[model samples]
Target: CLEPGTLPEPQLVASFLDLNAPVLARACLLLECAFFVNRCNRGEWPSWMKMNLPLPMQQAEHLTQASSQHIAISISGPAGANSDPID
Candidate 1:
Protein backbone atom coordinates (compact mmCIF):
# COMPACT_ATOMS: atom_id res chain seq x y z
CA CYS A 1 0.00 0.00 0.00
CA LEU A 2 2.93 2.32 0.54
CA GLU A 3 3.59 2.88 -3.14
CA PRO A 4 6.13 5.71 -2.92
CA GLY A 5 3.91 8.73 -3.60
CA THR A 6 2.21 11.72 -2.09
CA LEU A 7 -0.67 11.43 0.35
CA PRO A 8 -4.18 11.49 -1.03
CA GLU A 9 -6.40 14.27 0.19
CA PRO A 10 -10.13 13.90 0.88
CA GLN A 11 -11.16 16.76 -1.37
CA LEU A 12 -14.94 16.90 -0.88
CA VAL A 13 -15.46 15.84 2.71
CA ALA A 14 -16.65 19.30 3.76
CA SER A 15 -18.87 19.53 0.74
CA PHE A 16 -20.42 16.19 1.66
CA LEU A 17 -21.33 17.54 5.07
CA ASP A 18 -22.54 20.83 3.61
CA LEU A 19 -24.93 18.92 1.38
CA ASN A 20 -26.34 17.23 4.52
CA ALA A 21 -24.80 13.88 3.61
CA PRO A 22 -23.33 12.70 6.89
CA VAL A 23 -22.84 9.14 5.75
CA LEU A 24 -20.78 10.45 2.86
CA ALA A 25 -18.91 12.78 5.18
CA ARG A 26 -18.06 9.98 7.58
CA ALA A 27 -16.90 7.76 4.75
CA CYS A 28 -14.74 10.50 3.33
CA LEU A 29 -13.31 11.35 6.73
CA LEU A 30 -12.56 7.72 7.41
CA LEU A 31 -10.70 7.51 4.13
CA GLU A 32 -8.71 10.60 4.96
CA CYS A 33 -7.86 9.20 8.35
CA ALA A 34 -6.90 5.87 6.87
CA PHE A 35 -4.60 7.46 4.36
CA PHE A 36 -3.04 9.61 7.04
CA VAL A 37 -2.44 6.69 9.35
CA ASN A 38 -1.10 4.58 6.53
CA ARG A 39 1.31 7.29 5.56
CA CYS A 40 2.39 7.55 9.15
CA ASN A 41 2.94 3.82 9.27
CA ARG A 42 4.92 3.94 6.05
CA GLY A 43 6.75 7.03 7.23
CA GLU A 44 6.14 8.73 3.93
CA TRP A 45 6.98 12.27 4.91
CA PRO A 46 10.00 12.67 2.70
CA SER A 47 13.00 13.32 4.98
CA TRP A 48 10.91 13.90 8.06
CA MET A 49 10.37 10.35 9.26
CA LYS A 50 12.05 7.03 8.65
CA MET A 51 10.10 3.78 8.45
CA ASN A 52 9.49 2.17 11.83
CA LEU A 53 7.54 -1.02 12.44
CA PRO A 54 6.63 -0.15 16.00
CA LEU A 55 5.08 3.13 14.94
CA PRO A 56 3.10 1.27 12.31
CA MET A 57 1.75 -1.14 14.92
CA GLN A 58 0.67 1.64 17.24
CA GLN A 59 -0.84 3.67 14.42
CA ALA A 60 -3.03 0.79 13.30
CA GLU A 61 -4.55 0.40 16.73
CA HIS A 62 -4.92 4.16 17.13
CA LEU A 63 -6.73 4.42 13.82
CA THR A 64 -9.35 1.95 15.00
CA GLN A 65 -9.95 3.94 18.16
CA ALA A 66 -9.88 7.27 16.36
CA SER A 67 -12.23 6.14 13.60
CA SER A 68 -14.75 4.76 16.06
CA GLN A 69 -14.73 7.92 18.15
CA HIS A 70 -15.13 10.18 15.16
CA ILE A 71 -17.90 8.10 13.65
CA ALA A 72 -19.73 7.88 16.95
CA ILE A 73 -19.59 11.63 17.43
CA SER A 74 -20.80 12.31 13.92
CA ILE A 75 -23.65 9.83 14.24
CA SER A 76 -24.84 11.58 17.36
CA GLY A 77 -25.22 14.78 15.29
CA PRO A 78 -23.95 18.32 15.80
CA ALA A 79 -26.79 19.36 18.06
CA GLY A 80 -24.95 18.09 21.11
CA ALA A 81 -21.62 19.90 20.69
CA ASN A 82 -22.89 22.94 18.81
CA SER A 83 -25.21 23.65 21.70
CA ASP A 84 -22.49 23.41 24.32
CA PRO A 85 -19.37 24.56 22.41
CA ILE A 86 -17.37 24.44 25.67
CA ASP A 87 -17.86 21.03 27.23
Candidate 2:
Protein backbone atom coordinates (compact mmCIF):
# COMPACT_ATOMS: atom_id res chain seq x y z
CA CYS A 1 0.00 0.00 0.00
CA LEU A 2 2.32 2.70 -1.24
CA GLU A 3 1.09 6.22 -1.76
CA PRO A 4 1.96 8.32 -4.73
CA GLY A 5 4.14 11.47 -4.58
CA THR A 6 5.12 10.76 -1.02
CA LEU A 7 8.51 9.19 -0.43
CA PRO A 8 8.64 6.30 1.93
CA GLU A 9 10.78 6.30 5.04
CA PRO A 10 14.35 5.08 4.63
CA GLN A 11 13.72 1.87 6.52
CA LEU A 12 10.69 1.10 4.39
CA VAL A 13 12.54 1.89 1.21
CA ALA A 14 15.34 -0.44 2.29
CA SER A 15 12.90 -3.18 3.14
CA PHE A 16 11.20 -2.75 -0.20
CA LEU A 17 14.55 -3.10 -1.94
CA ASP A 18 15.25 -6.27 -0.01
CA LEU A 19 11.86 -7.66 -0.83
CA ASN A 20 11.88 -6.82 -4.54
CA ALA A 21 15.42 -5.98 -5.51
CA PRO A 22 15.18 -6.33 -9.27
CA VAL A 23 11.93 -4.49 -9.80
CA LEU A 24 12.74 -1.80 -7.27
CA ALA A 25 16.17 -1.36 -8.73
CA ARG A 26 14.70 -0.72 -12.17
CA ALA A 27 12.19 1.73 -10.76
CA CYS A 28 14.91 3.50 -8.82
CA LEU A 29 16.95 3.84 -11.96
CA LEU A 30 14.02 5.48 -13.69
CA LEU A 31 13.53 7.83 -10.77
CA GLU A 32 17.17 8.78 -10.80
CA CYS A 33 16.92 9.57 -14.49
CA ALA A 34 13.91 11.74 -13.84
CA PHE A 35 15.70 13.61 -11.07
CA PHE A 36 18.68 14.13 -13.31
CA VAL A 37 16.51 15.58 -16.04
CA ASN A 38 14.85 17.87 -13.54
CA ARG A 39 18.17 19.06 -12.24
CA CYS A 40 19.45 19.71 -15.75
CA ASN A 41 16.38 21.71 -16.58
CA ARG A 42 17.05 23.82 -13.51
CA GLY A 43 20.63 24.47 -14.72
CA GLU A 44 22.36 23.06 -11.70
CA TRP A 45 24.39 19.89 -11.36
CA PRO A 46 25.88 18.14 -8.39
CA SER A 47 29.38 16.68 -8.55
CA TRP A 48 28.27 13.07 -8.90
CA MET A 49 26.23 13.35 -12.09
CA LYS A 50 28.38 16.15 -13.46
CA MET A 51 31.48 13.95 -13.17
CA ASN A 52 30.11 11.60 -15.79
CA LEU A 53 29.31 8.40 -14.01
CA PRO A 54 27.81 5.53 -15.96
CA LEU A 55 24.25 6.69 -15.40
CA PRO A 56 21.42 6.63 -17.88
CA MET A 57 21.06 10.00 -19.58
CA GLN A 58 17.84 11.06 -21.17
CA GLN A 59 15.61 14.11 -21.38
CA ALA A 60 12.20 13.07 -20.15
CA GLU A 61 9.09 14.36 -18.50
CA HIS A 62 7.84 12.72 -15.33
CA LEU A 63 4.10 12.63 -14.98
CA THR A 64 2.10 11.28 -12.09
CA GLN A 65 -1.54 10.39 -11.82
CA ALA A 66 -3.35 9.38 -8.66
CA SER A 67 -6.42 7.15 -8.32
CA SER A 68 -8.03 5.25 -5.54
CA GLN A 69 -6.12 2.04 -6.07
CA HIS A 70 -2.73 3.14 -7.33
CA ILE A 71 -0.50 5.92 -8.58
CA ALA A 72 0.49 5.85 -12.19
CA ILE A 73 3.82 7.24 -13.29
CA SER A 74 4.31 8.02 -16.93
CA ILE A 75 7.76 8.78 -18.30
CA SER A 76 8.17 10.11 -21.79
CA GLY A 77 11.46 10.64 -23.47
CA PRO A 78 12.34 13.51 -25.79
CA ALA A 79 10.56 11.87 -28.70
CA GLY A 80 7.33 11.68 -26.75
CA ALA A 81 7.47 15.14 -25.21
CA ASN A 82 4.04 16.04 -26.47
CA SER A 83 2.53 12.66 -25.72
CA ASP A 84 1.54 13.43 -22.17
CA PRO A 85 -1.71 15.35 -22.08
CA ILE A 86 -1.61 16.34 -18.45
CA ASP A 87 0.81 19.18 -18.42
Please give the RMSD to the true structure for each candidate, in Å: 16.3, 19.1
C-alpha lDDT (0 to 100) for residue 14 of candidate 2: 55
TM-score of model 2 vs. true structure: 0.29
Residue by residue across 10-76, what tens digits does model 2's lDDT show?
5765576556568867587457656756776786666644676443432221122233124222343
**Per-residue lDDT of 26 in model 1:** 70
Question: What is the Å distance of residue 46 in model 2 from its true position?
Answer: 2.8
- Top model by lDDT, which number? 1
Between which residue pairs do clashes occur in model 1?
none
- lDDT by residue (tens digit), candidate 1, 6-61: 34445654455567656865785667667767876775654433443347779899
Clashes of 1: 0
C-alpha lDDT values of all predictions? 0.64, 0.52
